[model samples]
Structures are given as C-alpha cells and as structure tokens.
Target: MDLCFIVILLTFDVKSAPNPVNIAYTSVALSLHTDLVYMESPPGLQLLHCLRFDDCVEGGESTYLDLFHVVEEFRKSHPRYFQILSTIPATFHKCHYDRENPYHLVYQKPHIILNHRKQVVGLNWAPPFEGPLLVEEDDVLMYYEAYEELAKAIKNSDKILTYGMKVGDLMIFNNHRVLHGRNEFKLNDGIRHLQGCYIGIDDFKCKVQVLSNQVGDGQPPKHVGNQSWL
Candidate 1:
C-alpha cells in the first residue's frame, strides 16, 4: 500500500494517555529519533510548519543531528561496535489502536544501513519503538553495550543543532539522514502549535529531475546519478 501524507497539529494534550501510543501528545522531553523507523520504508522527507508560538515559553527548542557524520566518527572511535551495528538487524515494532482500523507494524533492520559498496548511508534509531532483543542470550550484553555507546555519542555530540522555531517558520529535512527531537516545555506557560507532513523520497526526486530538465540546457549534471538512493 502507498504511504499517506499526514498533517498533524503538535501540542500538549492533557487528556491523552502518556503511553508510547501517544508520547508526542505529552509535554515531556523527547530523545532524538527518526519517525516511523518500524516501517519497512519509512518516510523520506518531513516538513514541519509552525502555525503558532508563544514568545514567553521557556523551553521546547528543536534539536537535530546528522547520522552520517555520527557514523563516520563512530567508525573511528568504536570500530567494533560500528561493525556490529551495521551488520546485525534489530527489531522495531508498533501497534495502532482504532477499532475500525487497527494495525500492527514490525520491521527488522540494522541500526546503520549500508549501500551496495558497504558504505553507511542511512539508519533506524528510534529507541522508543525498539522491541525486545532478538539476538542470542550470549550476545545480548554485547549488543546492549554497543547500543548504549551509540546512544551516548548521539546525545553528547557537539554536531547537534538546536533552535527555537517561531510562528510561520517552516523546516524541511530528510528523515533518513537526520534525527530530530524536542526539549520539554511547561504547558501552562503558553501555547504552541505545529503542522507537519511526510513525502516519499522517490516522488520528490522525480519532481526535482523534471524541474532540472526543464531549466537545464538538455545536459545532465555531472554529479547526477553519482549517489545511490537507499
């Protein structure tokens, strides 16, 4: 089935349950993660538009990290852990509850996804949706060590960018290459609202190619096709 584009309003919902089913609905601080990592093919592009913002709010700054840069540094400092994560597949799962449209999603993939040349290209690192370890009992500890190390690297890395979005601000990013999250804010402090949607990378590329062809002098760019799509 084709993926659907979702436009959602993000705000603290006091009445919503504080479970994984609706963690985003709460005002708690969220860790860096890629959205829908449990899906076989997660959304490639995400667009967030801030509809309203309270100038008096104390926190809720947005955060982002480029996984590609993190992987490069990880390969140098912790080669063994990098190898293990890139080679072994881990479990990710989620269940949606709607009596009329209940569904369960599960996917198995390595924390670091490699291209045909064995080069790191993408990653799936949503800790909140991570399922139980499927590795052998003996290797469980080893995996956890690697997992913890990677998580620390991501959290403490100086490469992370932080910003406070304002009303009418729009941010577009590649979901496969970037991990995003937000800090906690007091709900009683003020109001905040954001609308977002996702789009497939393939469709986005096609549109770009068509536009480039129309504008270019009938010559494909030299860098075209040099990079492979994940």
Candidate 2:
C-alpha cells in the first residue's frame, strides 16, 4: 500500500565510532525531541524495527513523554512562560551541503500552536533542530526564560515512559504527541541495528477514526495524534 511503501527503510546502527554523520549513530544521550520539526508537515507516526540489540549494551533505553501532558502542566504552572512560547515564532532547520543526503530546510512556527480561546492545538518542538531564534531583541530574554522553564519541566517530569528494546522489537508512536529520546549506551563488543520509517499523519488519523466507527463504540478517539486538548 502507498502508506506502507518503504524507500529502503532508512537504517542506523549504534556503535562506537571516531566520527559519526548523525549524532544518533553514536554512544551519546539525546534530549527529548521529535523528528523533522523542520518539515512543513512532519511525519505523524514513526516505526522503528530493531534488527539487533545486544545484551552487552549497557544503556540505550528509549524514553518517551506525552507532550500534551507536559504542555498542559506547563500551561497551568507557568502561564506567562506558556504565553511567550505560544506567541513568539521560532525557526527550525535541517541544512547540509557536503553530505551524501544533502538537505536544506527551514520552517518557522510558534513553539506552541493555539486556537481560538488560546487552547493548545499542536506543538512544534525539536531542540536539536532549532535554528537561530531570530526574535525581537526584547523577546529574546523572555523566550529564553520560557524555554528554560519548559525544558526544566520536561527534564523533571515523572510521567516519562522508558523502555529498553530487544531484537525483533518494533516501536510505533505518534510523532506529534510524543517526545522521545535515548539514554547513553555503552556497546561492549556489541552493536545495535535499527531501521525506521514514517507514515503520513493524515492517513494514520483517518484509519484511527474509521476504526473507531467500525470497531469501537461509535465514538471518535479522544486524541488521534493531533495535539487537540478536547
């Protein structure tokens, strides 16, 4: 099917290397993030198939947090910070000229997307891909303050779901509603191989809604990867 077409299913192996093209290919810990925030319509869902995960790997546990939950907590505890992040525009980018997969992309959006009555509707958060903030001078300090609070909230949240994968394990999740990261891993004479790909959010959501009508109690799911609060 068109939705499941795989262009070779981009693969990545985690092993100790002198130099790595993508940071994810090394033994480094990643901060909370979603993929491709720099794309206008980032993928809605992600699938990672683990071809191998050796027992000797010390860490490398994947962590996830429901972004909507984090945002809701932030909106309640730090309304002003929430306001700043929701109103100010931030740019994210993916640029490379001398790489095999060359790409140059820039997308600008408010950190938090709001609808009428200032309700949280969606999110645009990917710290590693964030580009020059390029905000008004006065808003710079305010933006940083807001960024710090949100970052702190994420770091200290207790709702994080952590899981360590085994060989043949597959992980599927909503890219828009979940913020995921990795724990620093030590590959002790072992290697980790993973292949991943994405599916359009629109298609995923359509099937979810359709399934709810047919198999569920004829009620749409409360959430289908769209960051809608209600």
Q: How far is candidate 2 from the true structure (C-alpha RMSD, Å)?
A: 2.8
Task: List candidate 1 segments past 4 Å from native.
Answer: 1-21, 96-101, 211-230
Which candidate number maximizes lDDT?
A: 2
**What is the TM-score (0 to 1) of candidate 2?**
0.89
lDDT of 1 by residue, 65-167 (tens): 8887888899899999998898777899987775356769988788987678767767888999999878778777778889999999999999999989988
Provide the global lDDT of candidate 2 against the true structure.
0.82
The clash count of every prediction, one per candidate, is 0, 0
| Model 1: per-residue Cα lDDT at residue 204 | 65
**Candidate-wise lDDT, in order:** 0.76, 0.82
Cα error of candidate 2 at position 103, Å: 1.5
